[model samples]
Target chain A: MIILNILFAIAWMALNNAYTPVDFVAGLLFGFLVIIVSRRVLTREPLSLQSWFTFSARRNYPLLVWRWAAFIVFGFWSIVKANIVMARIVLSPQLRLQPGIIAIPLDITSEIGITILSNLITLTPGTVALDVSSDRKTLYLHAMDARDPDALRRETKQEFERRVMELLP
Target chain B: MSLLEIVTLALTALGVLFIFLSSVGLIRLPDVYTRVHASGKSATLGVVGVLLGVAVYYVDLRVALEMLALIVFFFITAPVAAHMLDRAAYLTGVKPVAGTAPDDLEGAYNRETRSLR
Candidate 1:
């Protein structure tokens, strides 16, 4: 499937007589259409989208694209917010902190889902995703401050994991 | 000079500031784990900010897309690298800073047997 897409992208570039990045992107866009049409004619089963386009169980590309954008923006904003807090901690003279590890239960099951969630958690300031349990049911995270564990967990779930679940599911 | 240029310059400065903050945390933080927390998040976000500035300055679709792709790649990889490092540090039994209560994984692994229970 991937090889076919690559071939279509190459074909698009050749037909257009341009090899620039713009042409590559244009080729990819064209390749999507070519693959969509050819797959239906060649095989009875639908060919799943790959690479930039996510493959979901429902095969809804449009919705996936929208959610993916939202996820990126949210993730970026979360990073900004985390950084501000972390900077405050670093600059403060007192260095008052209650750092500790706590188990954050997992809601996303797939390996990709778990990976994405863990990575985002680590990327967000003040939180580091330590490890996943043997059964993959819980994620252990280290926080810069866990004076209020419930609030920390709540924010993580609401801001990071919730969006990740939406993106992957 | 223009609104877009002003925005680009601001983002670039913010990005540099975050990168600087990461270093500050690295120096002041007590432990290796905490240092990772400082370096990982700020560095990734810092680079992303700089890339955004570049993308904005270019103001072309292809350049913007390429920059976006770079941001995405950095975002995805940085955390994974940090997670691996953190796990390796933990399994090797690097202790946290003093005054931290209740080491949860203390019982989860056997340092003598070198195996996780």
Candidate 2:
């Protein structure tokens, strides 16, 4: 596991008493070599190191963490902006909101992914996910301002949904 | 006393202001759906602002990191709670304001079966 490798590297660094970026990287390489050589011995199975490497590469776990961090930051900023929208709607004299229920189609296939996307959408001021379709292809949400459903659909797909897919995929 | 302290105080004030605005929104908004929008979204940011202020006030790496984790956890959970409220309110046939329109979800839900078409 990635965490295991990092832990092994940290242990190496701790033992060596050399706390430097270069030293940490060297320790990581040494730890990875140990894993590569002893993976089969540890697992007691005929495991190919190359296959494991490919799996980690495909999964991109480290990158996934970074993307999630980025998404959280971006999500916070968007929520702040959405709050401003709410402030405007609430404080305005005329109250010109067009609240309605509209179903936006789903690109995320996994249940977890859809739920995360729905949660993020619900956090936005104008949108709250009401329900998902039986087939799971559509997500019906209540929007406080639905002047242009098409534009909202495109924005959701581009902004929130894309980040969620990248983080989950 | 310091720059970080100033930032912390400013963030706390902003957070309290957001909380005040959310309450005002709750009072001014017309119906259930719009009211939820005002309360749920603004209140979340308000809490986040206050939490961030606390994190800044500590000025320690561990504290900051833990606070960041807490903020993310709060963000994820707060929306879920709000979503549950909105979903429950809608399913129970709570009516919206007069001008609410273009409801694509009108026929999709079979309330008797509580399933979507």
Candidate 3:
């Protein structure tokens, strides 16, 4: 299983198009280092393959496909919109910037889902996911031009969360 | 300059501005909690913006893929770090905002519950 994980890491790195012979060797060394470190640091009982694979498979596959589709569409649209807004901000003689942090309630429970949502928010033009509640129930997002907090929250809930939930099993 | 170069410059400028604002927010924001808000969130966007600008200028598949991976890795790690920091802060008794209402976690820890583990 550990070897598999190492191979999986290598494959992922390769897929990123950053892999070279040096990188592969470095990755293997890193993998070995991680093993040694985990042996010392993790005193807890070893996790079962079923647990690990199940967890990963449940969280990653089909969900990722749906999420990617949603992301491609939403991400392109958001980028174009963000470019326009940013252009306006840059070109305007008088900068009318209204930036604020608005707390957004998130319905997704999985850590993976929350991470995706937050990253998506950050990737979008003018918003950033500042902080989340201790329980991971609420996301605090900073918006570049947040004139209406409630509306932003509602839009986030509908556009991001709704799509994310649909993607998740 | 050509239209493409103009676009690239604009993106690069925006990216740099994001990085600057993030750094400022990191310094100016009150408290460790708020600083994390600024640093983690803004840094991710700043990096993404820069990468996007680079991708626009280069327009290569490999660069684009690498940028996508960086974005994914950043998104996954930032929240986990924030979660760890929040947990640490709570453990150290860092107070929330004054008007903050009852915390749901209090009950969970207080309960003489059966060991789910």
- Expressed as tens digits, the lDDT of each residue in A32-143 for candidate 3 is 5554445323324346644434434333433454566767788556644654444444445664545555666678998878877876675556665655666677776656
Error of 3 at B74 (Å): 2.2
Number of the top DockQ candidate: 2
Please give the RMSD of candidate 2 to the true structure.
5.1
Best by TM-score: 2
- Residue runs of model 3 more than 4 Å from their true location after superposition: A1-68, A71-160, B97-117
What interface RMSD, in Å and to 1 decimal, does model 1 have?
Answer: 1.7
lDDT, residue A47, model 2: 65
Better of 1 and 3 by DockQ: 1
What are the per-model DockQ values?
Answer: 0.51, 0.67, 0.08
* Cα lDDT of model 2 by residue, A1-169, tens digit: 4676788889988999888767878887788677666655554544675655554432444455567679877877779888998888778898787888887888889999998998889887589887788889998888998888888889888988888988664
Q: Is the docking of candidate 3 incorrect, acceptable, medium or high quality?
A: incorrect
Q: Would you give me the overall lDDT of model 3?
A: 0.60
Error of 3 at B81 (Å): 2.6
Q: What pairs collide in candidate 3?
A: none
Residue A167 in candidate 3, Cα distance off native in Å: 1.1
Model 2, position B78, has a per-residue lDDT of 74
